[model samples]
Target chain A: MGAEFYHSVHLDVELCKGCINCIKRCPTQAIRVQHGKAKIIKEYCIDCGECIRICPHHAKSATYDSIDILKKYEYTVALPAPSLYAQFNNLDDIDIVLSALKSFGFDDTYEVSAAAEMVSEMSRNYIKKHREDAPFISTACPTVVRLIRVRFPNLLDHLLPFAAPVELAAQIAVKNAMEKSGLPREKIGIIFISPCPAKVTACKDPIGNTYSEVDGVIAIKDIYPLLLPHMKSVASDPEKCSVSGRIGVGWGNSGGESAGLLTDNYLAADGIENVIRVLEDLEDQKFGDLEFIELGACNGGCVGGVLCVENPYVAQSKLKKLCKYLPISRNHLGDEVPQGALFETEIEYEPVYKIGKNLAESLALMARIDELCKKFPGLDCGSCGAPTCRALAEDIARGFAREGDCIPLLKESILSLSETISPNQ
Target chain B: MEKNIKLSYIVSPNDFLSAGAVSEDVKAHLEEMEIDSEIIRKATLAIYESELNMIIHANGGIIDIEITPDSLNVEAADNGPGIPDIEQAMEPGFTTLKPNSDMKAKGIGKGRGLSNIRKCTDFFDIETELGCGTTIRFGIDLK
Candidate 1:
């Protein structure tokens, strides 16, 4: 209703087989197979990339900046996600990856993991000061933040009000680039190498914050092959580019954020379903004594992103091995939260799942949906283009669909109609 | 005047796995109807606590929810053994659940179910007979 919500996940119509795979796998039930093609209900989409991971036809793809985007600015600084370090095999030094990024045509590189360390320090202080709020939910994962914005409004206040690591890195990258190159803000490109599509959406349409510092986002998979050759050249004499240490690089895996907090009284859950369950229980005030809740939309955290090349578990182990030799943390914020660290804008509840406009109308429509639910089979087979019988009923009540769309119901009605028109033999 | 929407669910006894299904469903429904978040939160907690009580103590029960424009009324009727002392049962940390009971093992049945239900809802009522059954009624104002 308000311009269709921006989503990084897209359906390549030419490749789509209209299979029910993505429709069933969507955590938010946003996908519907209509007209023999999967349609994402934009408002309901959190850009979790579950569809991209589940689509058999490979039709579901994420939208991101191409290699040509590097040419747009006078000076471009690549902000590599922590997950990027986990992509390489036997990647002993993080400088190898950073140097490779620079050799691959980037004017400079800033490790997002470095900024993650700063964020971790800030989060520790925030949690200590806001003990009354106790279990503050991490706002690093854009998909998790977006999911909370829509579905779990009750826990909105519990969200950590800080910019994500990549965003903080972008802000710092842009500032440093501007001072060094004597260039205007528009001339400097602070591009992020992202592990997931949700970051692309975060850059385009940010939540919690008013504006995103990152100019463009390129999927890790896209940049993975191009950087491999550069990695070999820079492996022997890599630049002094690594600023982050263990705590920062550890952000690549699940439980890493909580581990960074250095608090045993925290709960960390990964995978979208698990995150949802945590949020649901949190809303019920289940975890009373937890100091923080770290929720990642991806299974093994950023390393498990849909755009990553390596296996998530393998990547996690690689990340652990890489961090073993690094320092505890390289970045530190003594007493004050840095400027641009906190969210400038408040995240509001979207209530996208509401059935009707007002209370009276919603009640009526809900009643209608219940009545329709009684008529339709409860198999949730997804043949009617909707995920479940209840979803179809909601669609029908909203006038987007009809009961006739249900194949099984149509068959029954047709059989009864024929019997009424022509007496039984 | 809008007609009240009535929803019902049956809580199975000692089914710790599916204990919170009804409350979750009811919460989702209320969210779809665009109910006030605070009211939904209160209603969900109350319903969840009552549902757990039915599973842990009352063998099983039928939970009926009546949703109107201004309020939500819930009635959890159980045919299992009823509460012997309503006054003592109303106190927090007075749970009859043994430490090894399935619910207790799952970190629930903390004796706060009844108190929590009463604390969260606008109105709370309990009717019980030692051998016959028990019914806990609660309501929350939606406005």
Candidate 2:
């Protein structure tokens, strides 16, 4: 792994209490409390925002472009994610939101859900054509893709070789903006109204593709308040701006992407933990003859992102209600899948968790870790700053820590030393 | 320097909930050693299938695992009722599970345990005696 790996989720040193909450909750074990503060190993982090969601002190925050970014370009397009539709009280019409986006200072508005429908169509055809490689994992969630890239090496071939809907939407939005406004590509900003920090990192440092078309990413939470008043003003005479239908809007909730594929053989799992379990089972070939695997790092897909404002279940129901009267699908692709929609680069696995540089060194390190583990108590108390006792042993074996770091073992040694030196009292 | 790591686990009888715990532990170790992903998958699958067999059929068992730079070796031994027909038991879909057993409800006994173990390992052997017990041994080459 190189120093080029970028992470959007960062810690606020002022607010951190150096608690073990983040270290324990990180699915990748990327975080560790050292010297009374949490340090995130950049190579190990997937920018999944688990620390952001778990931090009780509000010390963790995601980096994204502010609303002021609209002024940087002559023409700006707001690409609203489907989860953005689920944030309002009674948003029966998607046009109201789209019109408000225009009122919110963007020159034009594009729905990411529209591109999602196209991706769904492309995936269905891909699955049918690649029957030998039946179970393709969804790459819509950047967190899931990064997780697979670092952890699950055996399942790399199964990743759907397509750009995320937001990426495709940005490309189309930029192309349309340049043609309509008679401006150069740089002058037209393709901004994404994102639901999570993973998308921000994905745009900045793309994995499957060489570069992302998205110029800037703004969080839904930051844009929620500004759009509300605009939404209220446009509700009465909203422009007919919604281009997507039920299948597209359904992408907001868990299992929504799989549902759009129109297949009962697919399996959809949400939340990072559940996604890891499914990937592990898939590696062992546990699920027989599945067509597709949809994984969301958040609890209820994009709605449960740490950057979103509404409760995920509430947003899910609202999304269902909003899509109730809409058509099955409004967007349709041609007989051939578009070239721009596919990934241009291959995603290679990064063995960040490997204990050493090679097999011989790794064996030596593993043996030393095992030896250290035997000396330390098997209590997985995070007092040593590591998540588990075994993790502490690994840290010791790597020379990043020492056995004296174990508070319990250190206490015992100190007590014995005092007892031996004091003589019989 | 060459070093061989050894591990052991005692599988409790009918403990369906925690049956795969040993295999998960072994898999974690292999992951730390940076073993090839395919090899880790095969090793874990074979261990998991053998563990399930001990819990579902044999009255618990003891599993011993040895890992070296070149290979992974496992021996699962149990003193439960021996297999009456070795040939039939090795066949796919050949299970002694009752139609309405508790294991069936939990989706455990699919009759693919032994066959899957054999399929995942490079070397596999089984020994059984009518009045005694059954022991299964398997190995996968890491190189």
Candidate 3:
């Protein structure tokens, strides 16, 4: 909970032009332009990295874990997301990527995609047994889960109760490393190679879960530059790298999870704006027969993440080709659910931004703002330092700005006062 | 009430793309005013259902909104074909629009719109004159 305030995404004030581009693009309306710079209201932000992608000035950036962070632990294991495979073009072998990760001073590499397959299998049975009126929403994307918590509080019950693939893989990696090296659990560091800022925030301040098993999060963009030097020469043993089923590798792209379910009656949407619209439809109970609804905040799933190097379309194509070639998983962890990794705790709504402290004050404020909205122009031109005309009205009601702050209103008042003071002058 | 704010909008017919513009506007206004989150959500859902009904069923309609200290009120009047039996229409899963038809393909007339609107608001009322038009009034109390 304390780590929610420590967002990986940050704005460089010197580079911001205050053009209102980010203010308009943010899905949560967490950004505001003030004093010729943009400010992020920490509580409202879900760290989806939408502003990072839309900012033309490149003022917003995702922070990555420095290489030095791995020095503390005796054993360091790299748990790479499947999106990492989509980063390099024409990469035929999974061992090449795993070996390249080992060259970066890691003891072993674990495939998060393997864990993804297990999760998909678990979800198929969960949806079958615990049926509800609404479709079960996938909790794979941390940003999407947080969106449900903030916007659709009533639909929290609809989310599938299971740990994300990355979380499960991190715990598994740590356990395996401790067994192999005969070291204490605290000595093993399981670092996740994440494709988005949301994963970084999730690792630090996990939602629903008590604590995150992962120790550090390094952005995929940061590792891409370092791995280019090692991809040319790799280990010969293919068994050293973790390889999973084709369905798991396909999870890097949108609709991949739904396809794994083998169910025709499902809905899949990508991108934050599109996800919001789909959630609204789901709230209306339009897709009554839908067994699952897979939503990713990125445009083309993790391949289109803000912190990734490759283009989403090109990466999606590569991911598909790789999925077609990979063999299915033979190893099975039969019906037993992992003890610490299961999502057993109930997740409560995080109403970070409420109108007022109490009921009466909120009602009074609403009445005051309604009265002020009538005076402002309804065009929402954004001429008065606010994103919309209604925002300016709220500003006036909150006593943050004067009503005359509007340029048009100020001019009209001045012209009327001059005429009234001197007749026919 | 010490003060009252009134807003009116004209919903264009068959503009499936822009059907939710009015509801979105009202939701934004409620958000800016720092209204209760629960109340805003209920009002927005009711307005959204009303807007979709006006656009899909009726050719077009006039949406009149009134926001006061006590409650948020919306009155939608459409000149479309009015329902002969109000009781049956109010029942959930009683959609007149056929599946995969023109209107259903556009994702409207789910038969849950009226029932959903009724569930979201504290006060719900509808009056219709068979072949003339239909008028629906609903309010969600902020208090």
lDDT of each: 0.90, 0.90, 0.81
The root-mean-square deviation over C-alpha atoms between each candidate and the true structure, in angstroms, is 1.8, 1.7, 3.5
Q: Where in model 3 is the C-alpha error above 4 Å?
A: A1-5, A235-239, A358-360, A378-385, A395-425, B1-5, B26-49, B56-59, B67-72, B80-101, B104-124, B129-132, B139-143
TM-score (second chain) of model 3? 0.94
Supply the global lDDT for candidate 2: 0.90
DockQ of model 2, rounded to 2 decimals? 0.69
Q: Which residue runs of candidate 2 sit more than 4 Å off their true CA positions? A: A1-3, A423-425, B98-102, B108-110
The TM-score values for the models, in the order shown, are 0.96, 0.97, 0.88
Query: How many pairs collide in each candidate, listed in order?
Result: 0, 0, 0
**Number of the top DockQ candidate:** 1
Write one digit per residue (lDDT tens) for candidate 1, span A289-399.
989999999989999999999999999999999999999998998666777888887788888899888888898898889889999988899998899999999999899
**Across residues A230-346, which tens digit of lDDT does each residue of candidate 3 receive?**
877664543356567787888889998887676878888999999998987676454567788999999999889998999998999998888887776533457696665567578
lDDT over C-alpha atoms for residue A100 of model 1: 91
The CA lDDT at A361 in model 1 is: 84
Error of 1 at B25 (Å): 1.6
Candidate 1 - CAPRI tier?
Answer: medium
Complex DockQ per candidate:
0.69, 0.69, 0.30
